[model samples]
Target: MKPSIPYLLAYAFTLASRRADEELREHGLTVRQFGLLMQLRLEPELTMAELARQLGISRQSLHEMVGELEQAGHLRREPGATGRTLRLTLVPGTARLLFDAHGPLMRAEEDFLRGMGKREIETLRVLLQRVLAHATDDEAWLA
Candidate 1:
């Protein structure tokens, strides 16, 4: 039997994830932690529940990660506008951490796509976006 698209995609994702883990490990970060930070960075005012939903994790799990991040000085929670909600925001110096972490991942991607031209990469991105658009009900996370 031949490899299917889904199989190939999963294999590609595994390769990318492994590379990300190795690179992020150098900075004392796990992929999940990095994802949490990125989500908070993109939407600074997300409440715990909202963040959990966006991250596709449970609230309890998000809370645990939030505690760790807070202790590490990477994130903080403030009272939301409703006063009953707690909003997650990146800490003051978190930009430097994010910037530092971003470089290695991008470099890894470039290395992985070494022979791909700019136009080819753009086309690949567009195709992936189309697939994602078709697969998910909520496009908010795609933004």
Candidate 2:
């Protein structure tokens, strides 16, 4: 029997995330933590809510991740410009981790799509974005 679309995508994502997670763990980071670092790197000084929104995760979950990261000395916490908001400062440790993991991460992604042709992957990206757009549109209408 053929698996449903969501089931197949979930399976693929789980396997890919596990691979990336293993690579990142060697550097003392989880995939979610790496996502936080990526967010900070891309949009400096994002508040916890903003970070959660950007990552499509809960603020409470992000808060827990931040606590863990700060404890690990990978990040420094600072007060945001606005009232009671929290900001994350990337420590040198995180920068080093991200830099060192670059090759492995890239190779992991390459290995993931090795089974699929480039054109196929590109088409998949377009289709996925269309699906996401419709979902977000429905959400906006509901709001």
Candidate 3:
């Protein structure tokens, strides 16, 4: 029997996450933590709401994650320019760790996508983008 698209997507997500977890393990980061760090690196000083939107996670969960990262010296939160929100900033040392780990993570993804050529990869990207566009939280694609 042929697999449904949702099943295929779930399987792919699991495989990708597993590969990412393994690659990030040496750096002492879980896949979710690595994703959070990357988001912070990409959007410095982002408000908690904006960051939560980008991550497709709850603001409360993000708050907890921020606290953990703060304790680990990976990032910090401070009052936002508007004063109504808190903003996150990635620490320089932690930024370096993220930068260093990026190469290995990309390599891990490439290894997982091994038989795919450039065109195929691009096609897959486009298809995934389409799927993400229809997600309940449409903004998740930004992360």
lDDT (Cα, tens digit) per residue for candidate 2, span 31-128: 77887887687678678777787677888898889899889898888878875776789987677777787777777777878898889988876776
TM-scores for the candidates: 0.76, 0.77, 0.79
Best by lDDT: 1
Q: Candidate 2 regions off by >4 Å?
A: 1-5, 125-143
Q: What is the lDDT of residue 75 in candidate 2?
A: 86
RMSD to the hidden true structure, all candidates = 2.8, 4.6, 3.0
Q: lDDT rank, highest first?
A: 1, 3, 2
Q: Report the Cα lDDT for residue 76, model 3.
A: 78
Candidates ranked, most accurate by TM-score first: 3, 2, 1
Q: Mind giving the per-residue lDDT tens digits that candidate 3 earns over 25-113?
A: 88877677888998777668667877787777898898888888888888877778888877788877997888778877887789889
Q: Please list the residue runs of candidate 1 whose C-alpha ends up more than 4 Å from where it truly belongs after superposition.
A: 1-7, 133-143
> Relative to the true structure, how large is the alpha-carbon lDDT of every model?
0.82, 0.78, 0.81
Residue 101 lDDT (model 2): 73
Model 3 TM-score is 0.79
Report residue 25 deviation for candidate 2 (angstroms): 2.1
Candidate 1: tens digits of C-alpha lDDT, residues 2-74: 9999999989878877888788877777678988998788788777888787676899999999999899899
Scored by lDDT, model 1 comes in at 0.82
